[model samples]
Each structure stands twice: as structure tokens, then as C-alpha cells.
Target: MSAPVRADALATLTAWRPADPGQRALREAFLGFLAARPDSCARSCEPGHLTASALVLDATGDQVLLTLHPRVGAWLQLGGHCESTDATLAGAALREATEESGIEGLTIDPVPLHVDVHPITCSLGVPTRHFDVRFLVRAPAGARETRSEESLDLRWWPLDAPPDHELDDLLAAAQIAR
Candidate 1:
């Protein structure tokens, strides 16, 4: 595992310009958490861990690719826990997006579009929080996707007609409109 991932995370957060007061607060909390736990990027960190996620859009940015998460039973953006091999948060998010969507050649925005702290019983089978750093990803034109075992379903939803969920706030924050 690269120890630089933690440093990369701290740098990413420190350089990030939060979109709102809530985002600003989360960014501060994330910085504090990283300062305290050197292993915060690993899933085994117990109380919580840093996670990377990507919200994938088509080349034209008119459509989004989402997965029906088996764990959450809801269609959500593609992303998950950072791996030992990941060197940066943006890389981790892109890696998860690729692994889960089976789509290669995706372009990622290094800056995070959102930060969220949510509690769940992850693969560890224990309750923990996910300090998710979400990035925006753009797929190549005519991009084809295959569903990986990590998801129950995978498909593209038009931005104008997204699934009923929290993607609304995400879109709003990213300033993406139909």
C-alpha cells in the first residue's frame, strides 16, 4: 500500500474549494480525520475510512451511468473503497468507476464534486462511515459498459430523467442541468 495515498488525500482536501458551507465543513472534518489516522484510507480503519466515487457522464454530459447497488438496493454512482494500489483519491475513484462499470478510457476531474459522510455496514460486516470523495467522470463517445459483479444493474439514465434519488443534489452542486 502506498503511504502517499494519505498525503494525497490531505493535499486534495486542502486544495479543494468546497461548494457550500456544508461541503466546507465536511472538508474540514475530513482533514482532521486524515490528520489523526494514518490508515484512514484503508477500509480496516474500524470507525470509518476514506472512499472514492465517480459520477459518470456521457461525452456530451447529457447522460449518466449508474449502478443498482446490491448493498444499498438503490441506483447510485459508481465508486467504492480505495485499494492498496491506489495512489491518489482521483485515481481511486476512476479505478472504481472502471472496475464497476467495465468501461475504460474514462476521463476524471481531479477535483472532487462532493464530499459526504454516510454510515453503513460495508463488506466488513460491521457498521462504519464512508467519507466519500466524489469526482466527475466523462466517458468516451459511444462508450460501451459491462456490468461487474459489484453491481446488480448498470445502465445510462438521461440527465433530464434521472432515477428518483439524491443525484439531484449532486447535479445541483456540480451545476449540471438538463
Candidate 2:
């Protein structure tokens, strides 16, 4: 419900095109939360806790590697929390991709592609918020991958026909902008 989060959620929801009933509901709920809680802050079940994540593009710049998130069952970029050990947000993103995708020789652009703020409804029905700072990264030339346990599946996807998911539009936009 912070101003930044509210703005991000608003933009995301407006640009979103949900492909399934469940995703539509989820998207609506997220949009509604932002509309209702313009100033709710982190404590109000609003998106908070900044996390650094990445959309890893391959060396040729035609494909992006994505992971199938365990909980969400959706294809997404590799990223995680910026723990105390991380020197900067970009470092956190690098560590996460290295750990999650097992792809070596990567370089991340310091600038974030987008700031995604979303509320993750946990199994216990407790919602955790994430203000995800998403960066654009590139794998070394001809670098191969070994998907880690963190992802159900990891593979390179074309920028135009990324695997079906709710964030497809956002991902496409990010790729084009990059």
C-alpha cells in the first residue's frame, strides 16, 4: 500500500491479460487490493519486502531463460531475497540465478527492468508481499544450463512466444525495452 507499490500494482494489473480463470481471479484480487488500500503499507497485507529478481536473456539476445516456480506453477525469472550478505541488489539477483538455474558466466544489468509488487497468498492463507526489483541479465556466449532444484523446469524461451503465463506481456515488454 505504499505509494510505490500502489502505483506498480495499478500499472501491472492494467496491462495484465490473464489466460485462465484462476489467473483472472488472482489478478482481480491483486488489483482490488491496490484500489482499496492505497496507503495500507507493508503491515496491511500489502506488497512489501523488496526482492531482487532477474529475467535472464541468453547471449544471442533472442531467448530468455525462465524457471517454473514451484508454488505458482508459472514460468518466471530467477531471483530471491536480498539477504544481509548481499553487497547490493544486483549481487542478490546474480546469486539467485546462479543458484537456481545453474547457468554460469552470467552478467546482469544494474538497472531494473520493472518493479513488480504482488501479494503471495501462502498455504496458510497468510499473504506475503514482495516488491520485486526485476533486472535483465545475459548468459555467456554458448553457455549451457543445468536447472537447479528450485525450479520444476528451466529452459530457454523465445521472446515472442514465451510459455503461456500471466506475466507474458510484462516479459515481452521487458525484452523489447531492453
Candidate 3:
């Protein structure tokens, strides 16, 4: 297994702000879900574990930054597993955004926008349930693009008419939610 990422480093990502009502409600619901089934991680959601991620919206609020996922061949948000280094789930999401998107100076909300529990296929072929904590992020105004090896491609698309053809069901759901 790879070395776990650090939480304190993740915490240094960005500042936080009060979450909106909708976001707070979502967070509460997610927490409740976790509380109800304490062993969901090791049992129901085995193989995969809890994760955090960020969906970066561009300046105009009409487009989002997406990565062309290599394995699934879909355009998706930036995120990864919540490693030991993550200060909090939100911090992990921000760290993922900065590392994967290569976009600097992203402003992130401290609270998650939504928490989704879903199964995803990894390279190993076993279906793993990812307890995904998602946050909304915004890049600096007029920020330029940057690329990383993890992505096949990175681009901004109009939210109104996203490139759905290049996305999978989960990513498509995220697009529609935005």
C-alpha cells in the first residue's frame, strides 16, 4: 500500500467559512448516516473507504474544471482517499483539488457541499464503496490552466451544456447537481 497522506498538510490548504443552509443540512445528513452504521466502512463499504474531493467552479460560475479520468474514461472532479494526513475531510478535498487540478489559489469552503455514498470500480476490478465527501471550490479569477499526470486531459466546460458524452453516470450526476 502507498504511504498515507498527512492530515496536517491537508489542513494548510485553505481557510474556511460558514456553510450555507443547504450545505449544512447535507453535512448533518451525512453525519447521521455515518452514526447509524458505524461499521459501514469496514463492512458494507469494504475494499474502498471514506474519501474527500473538490469540484472546482470557474470564475464566471458557468463552467467547472474537470479531469479526464484515465481508467473510467470520464470527465470528473478532483479528489482522492482521505489519508491519515488529512486534518479533516474538507481539508483532504482541498488538498486533492490543488494536487490534481494544478490550479493554484483555490478558495474552498470548510464544510462539504454534499456527501455521497456510492460504489466505484477501481483498477483491481473489485467494486468499492466510496464514502465521498464533496466540497465546492473556486479558482482565482482569470487563473490559467495546469496539468498533472493523473489526468488524461483537463478543461473547463459550460455548466449549462456540459460535455456529457465524455462522462460516466456518477460524473454526470455531479454535473446535473451543479
| Count of clashes, each model | 0, 0, 6
lDDT of 2 by residue, 1-178 (tens): 2355445435645665645455466556656655776543244443445566888888888888889999888888888765555656667788998888787789997655665667786333577876566778889988888988788999999877888866675586565666
**Which prediction has more favorable lDDT, 2 or 3?**
2
C-alpha lDDT of candidate 2 relative to the true structure = 0.70
TM-score of each: 0.95, 0.70, 0.69
Give candidate 3's TM-score: 0.69
**Stretches > 4 Å off in candidate 3:** 1-33, 36-47, 123-125, 165-178
Which pairs of residues clash in candidate 1, taking residues 3 or more apart in a chain or in different chains? none
- C-alpha lDDT score of every prediction, in listed order: 0.89, 0.70, 0.64
- The alpha-carbon deviation from the true structure for residue 84 of candidate 3, after best TM-score superposition, in angstroms, is 1.4
Q: Which structure is stronger by lDDT: 1 or 2?
A: 1
Please, what are the lDDT tens digits per residue for candidate 3 over residues 15-113? 222244544454454555455544432323455556777878887666788888897687877887665555566677888899998888998866555
Query: Compared with the true structure, what per-residue lDDT tens digits does model 1 show for residues 12-31?
Result: 99999875898899999999
Worst 10 residues of 2 by lDDT: 39-48
